[model samples]
Target: MGPRFQNDDRVRLYREMYEQHGPIAPVVLPGDVPCWLVLGYRELHRITSDSALFSRDSGLWNQWPNIPADWPLLPMVGKQPSILYTVGERHHRRSALVSDALAAVDPFELRDRSERFADQLIDRLCGRGSADLIADYAKELPALVLAQLYGFSDQAGAELVPGINALVDGGPDALRGRDRVQAAMSGLLTSRREAPAAGVASRMLHHDYSSDFSFQEILEDMMVNFVAGHQPTADWIGNSLRLMLTDDRFAASLSGGRHSVAEAMNEVLWEDTPSQNIAGRWATRDTQLAGRHIAAGDLLMLSFAAANADPQVRPDRTSFTGGNSAFLSFGHGDHRCPYPAQDIAEGIARTGIEVLLDRLPDVELAVSAHALVWRSSPFLRGLASLPVRFTPTPTSAAGVYR
Candidate 1:
C-alpha cells in the first residue's frame, strides 16, 4: 500500500485494492506503520458520520510507542494543536471561528482577486509561448489570493508560496517549509493583533472563542487552514486543466464557450480530486467495521478516491458524473471541509481556469498527453508539471481576453 500510493495510475491501484480486499483492508504506511483503509462509499460515510467511535484525536493512536520522533509522517498524523486533532465541544467552537472568518470573505472580491492573480501569473509567461503550468500558474495563484484574504501583502504572500508548496509535497523540506509558513503566519497574527483589519486572520483573532485558546494554538489553526486551502485548490486547477486539455468532452472550454468549465471542474472532483486520500479517523473503542475486527486505537485511512469509485454507488464508473455531487472529495459529516472554505476553493479554481482559457484560447499540451507526470505524493494527486504551448500573447494585451 505504501508504494502503491505513489503509483501514477492510482485509479487502477485503488480498484485492485477494493477487488482484492473489499471495503476495509489492512495496510502498512510508508514507515511500516499499520492502518486500515476505508474504501467503500457507505463505509467511509459511516466512519466519518460516527465521529464518536472514529475520532479525529490522533493522541489515541496505539502505535505511538513504535513511532520514532523523526518519523516522516509525524508532522501530518501526529497529535498537533491544530483543529484537525481537536474533538467535541472545543472543536465545535474552533470550527465556527475558522468557518466564520473564511465566510466573511466577500465572494465577489474572491472572484475578482482570483482573476487578477491568474492574469498576473499568466502575464508573466504569456509572451514565452511555452511554460510549465504547474510551476508558473496553478501552484502560485491560490496562496497569493489567500495571502490577501489572510491580511498578508502580495509580496509577503509570494514569499510564502515556495515554502507552502514544499510543505504540502511532504518532501525532505516539509519540516523546514512548515517552519517558514508558521513564522510568516506568526508575523501576520502579530500584525493583525496590533492593528485589526478586514481579513480572515483578523476575523479569527476577533472571534468570541478566540480567547479560549492560546495564541500559538490559534496560529496553528491558521496554518492548517491556509495549507489545506492552498495545495488542494492548486491541484484542482492543475488537474482540471489537464482534463480539459486531454478530454474531447471539455475541449469546447478552450474555444470561447464557458459552459464546459464547470462540468470539467465538477468531473475532476469526482474522478481525480486533488485530495485523493486523507490521514484519517482513529478508532476510539473496539468496533467492527465492514465485517472486520478493528481494535481500539487503530488508525483508519480515508480513501476518498476509492470511495468515490466504489462500484456500489458508481455502478457505471465510465459514465459522466455531470452535476451529481455525492463524491467525498471534500469529505463528509461533522469533520468535512467547512462549507465556506469549499466555496473559496471552488471560486479560486474555477476562476483560475476560466481566466486562463479566456486569455490563451489556443493553448494545448506541449508534449504527448502520456508524457505528463503526476507528482509522487501518496496523499496528493496533481501533475508535477503540465507543459503547455500556445500562440504567444503579448503582456501588453493581457487584460484583453478573448
Candidate 2:
C-alpha cells in the first residue's frame, strides 16, 4: 500500500508493483489482511464510478469477522456513521452540504489567511538561516488555517495542532489525538449552534439538509473533514517544496521564477501526490475487474499513486506533465474529494509555497536530497524532514495573527 522502507523510492516501488502485477493484484495489510490493490488507472476509475457494485460501506467487507479489536486498520476500515460510509440518497445530500459549506469560504480571505500563516511560520526561522521546512512550516500551516475555517479561534486552533499531527501519524498517540480532536469538534459545534457565527461548522449546521443529518452524524463528518483537510494539504506543500528544491526542472523557482512554482506544484500532483492510496471500496456483488474474480464483500484498496503512474495513460512517465489535472491524486466519481474542497486545498498549498519563496529566495537544502527520508505510512506519502539553509534575515515586524 505504501513504501516499505523509509528511504525507498515510491515511484520505483510503484513501477515494480505494476510490472509484476499488471493492473490489479492481491496484497496483505499490516495484520495480514488480504485485499485487492487496484493499481490500474482505468480499473480504479471503473471501481469509483460504479458505487452500486463497489460500495463505500465498510460493513460490506468480508474480512470483518477475522478483524481483531486491536487491529490498527480498524480506525480506517471500521464501520462508522460518517459520510465516508454513507450510501445512496443520504450520502449525496451529505456530500452537497459539505461542498456548499466549503464553497462559501471566500477565496480572497482564504488566500489572505494562507499568506498570513505562512509568513508567521517563516518569520520564526528566517533569522536562523536554517530550518526543517516540514516540521516548522509545511506541517503547521494547514491545520492553523483549517482551524479558523472550521470555526475555532486562533488560540483554540493552535492548541489543536499537535493532536491533528499525531492523529495523522497513526502512532501510539493516535487514540489520544483522536480524542483531543473529537473533544474540540464537539465544543466547536456546540458553540456554533448557540451563536451561528461564520465558518464551515456554522454553515453545515444551518444547511437545508441539516435536519436530515443528526448531530452525531454532523460531528463525525466534521472530524472526517478536519482530518482530511489538514494532513494531505500539509503533505502537498512539503512535497512540492521538496521537488522544487531538488529537481533541476524547477531550479529557476528557487531563484525567483514565480511561474515555475505553479509548474512545480502541478508536477508534484502527478509525480509525488500526498494522498497516495485509500482504504477503499467493498464489493457489493461478485464481479470481475482486470481479469481478477471478485467475491461479494471483498475489499479493494485504491493505489492512487500507482494508478496515476499507470503506463497505460502515462506512456511517457519521464516527460513533464505540464498543466495536466487528470491525475487521480484525488479519487473520482461519487466519493471523490469535492471540487470546492480541492480549490481550497490548492489555495492553501500554492500560497504557502509562494510566500516561502518570496521570503527566502536563496533557500536550498541543508542535507543532500538523496539523504532525505520519507514518512512510512500505508496511505499518505511525504518527507520526514526537509532541512535547509538560507541567508539570515530579520523576522516580520507585524503583530501576531489572531
Candidate 3:
C-alpha cells in the first residue's frame, strides 16, 4: 500500500482484510515484505502471549535475506539489543532494569511537571486565539516529559523529540532518525556516567540490574523508553482530545460532567491505539495459529486497532469511554508494559489532557475531524496536526493557561 492509503484510511482496509482472511491474513507491506497480520483479538492475544510459539527475535526471521536493503522496514523489524527486540532471559533482565528505573520516578512529580509543560506550551499561543494542539501542545508535552524520565538533560528535549519522531515514522527518514537516536543516547549516557544524574540511565547503571548490559545495550534501552514513551503517548493525548472535540456524546459527557479524563484515555486505547499495527514477531516453529497454516520463521504483525474493534470480542458499540483491559494496544505477555508503570504513563497522559481541557474549556476543533492528517508509518497512528481554536484566556502573574 502507498503511504497515503496505508495511513489515512487504514481502518477501512483492515476491516476488508479481516473479511477476506479472518483472524490471520497474509499481506505485503510497502516494500513487498510479506507477513501475517493478526486481526482477531483472541488470535492476537494467543500469538503475543505465547512467546514460545511466536518469537520476538528478528534474527530468526528468514525473510530479511530476500528483502532489499532500502525496503524501509529495517527500523521496525531490524535487530536491536533492547528489551523490545530481545527474547527469553535477555528480555527479562532488560525489563527488570526498566521497571526498576521507572519505579524510581515519582508519579506525582511526573504529573506536576507534565502540567507545567502543558501550561508552558499553551501559554506560548493561548493569547493568540488559535492553537495547533498537535504542534503546540500534544507534541512536546510527552517529548519533554519522557526526556526527563529517560534522564536526559531537559535542555536537549527540543533536539531529541523530532529525531526520535523520525525514527518511529517508519519511512525514508527512519534510518536517519535512528542514527540521531543512537548519537543522542550516547551523549546522554556519557554525560550521565560522568556526572551521575537522576533518571533511567542513572538507576540502570547503579542499581542491581538483572542483566550485565554493555554501554551500547544501555543506549538501546534508553531509546526503547524514549521511543515507547514519545509518539504513542503524544498520539494518545491528541487522539483523546480529538475524541472529546469530535464525538458529541464523548464531548458532552466530558464537558457535561458525566465522564472522566481517565475514561477518555481508555476509550482512545480501546479503539484508536497509537501503534495501530506492530510489525514484529516471527513463528518459532511450524505451527497453526488459530487453525491457519503457518511456517517457521514467518514474519507476523498484530493489528491492535482491528483486534480491539473485533465484533466478536467487543460487541458494545455504545461508548468508547471505558476501555477494556484486554485490548492489545500496549500488547501483552513478556514484552507488554508493566503495571503501575503503565498506570504512571496513563496518569501523565490524563494529567496532560486534563490540563488542556480545564484551561481551554471553550476550545473547539478548527477543522473537521475527518480532515485531519495521520502520520504515514507501518506501525504508528498519529495525527499530523490538531488545529483548535479557543477564546483567549488571560494569563496571570502565576503564569498559568488561565
- Tell me, by TM-score, which candidate is best: 2
lDDT (tens digit, per residue) of candidate 1 on 1-402: 345566556777877888899999899987899999888999999999998999999999999999999897776698888899899999999999999999999999999889888888888889889999999989999999999999998788889999998888778997799899999999999998989998999999989989998899889899999999999999999999999999999988999878899999999998888998888999999989888999999999998999999988987878999999989999998889999999999999999999999889999999988888888776778989999999998764436322
lDDT of 2 by residue, 1-402 (tens): 444534556667767788898799888987898999898999999999999999999999999888999897787788889999898999999999999999999999999998888888888888889999999988899999999998898899989999999988888998899999999999999998889999999999999999998898999999998889888999999999999998899999888788999998889888888898898999999998888999999999998888998988998988999999999998999999989889999999999999899889999999998899888877888989999999998777644443
Model 1 stretches astray by more than 4 angstroms: 1-8, 396-402
TM-score of candidate 2 against the unseen true structure: 0.97
Relative to the true structure, candidate 1 reaches a TM of 0.96
Candidates 1 and 2 compared by TM-score, better number: 2
Tell me how candidate 1 scores on lDDT: 0.90
Per-model RMSD to reference:
2.2, 1.5, 2.7
In candidate 3, residue 256 scores what lDDT? 39
Q: What is the TM-score of each candidate against the true structure?
A: 0.96, 0.97, 0.91
Residue-pair clashes per candidate, as listed? 0, 0, 0
Query: lDDT of each model, Cα atoms only?
Result: 0.90, 0.90, 0.77
TM-score ranking, best first: 2, 1, 3
What local lDDT score does residue 329 receive in model 1, on the 0 to 100 scale? 97
lDDT of 1 at 227: 91
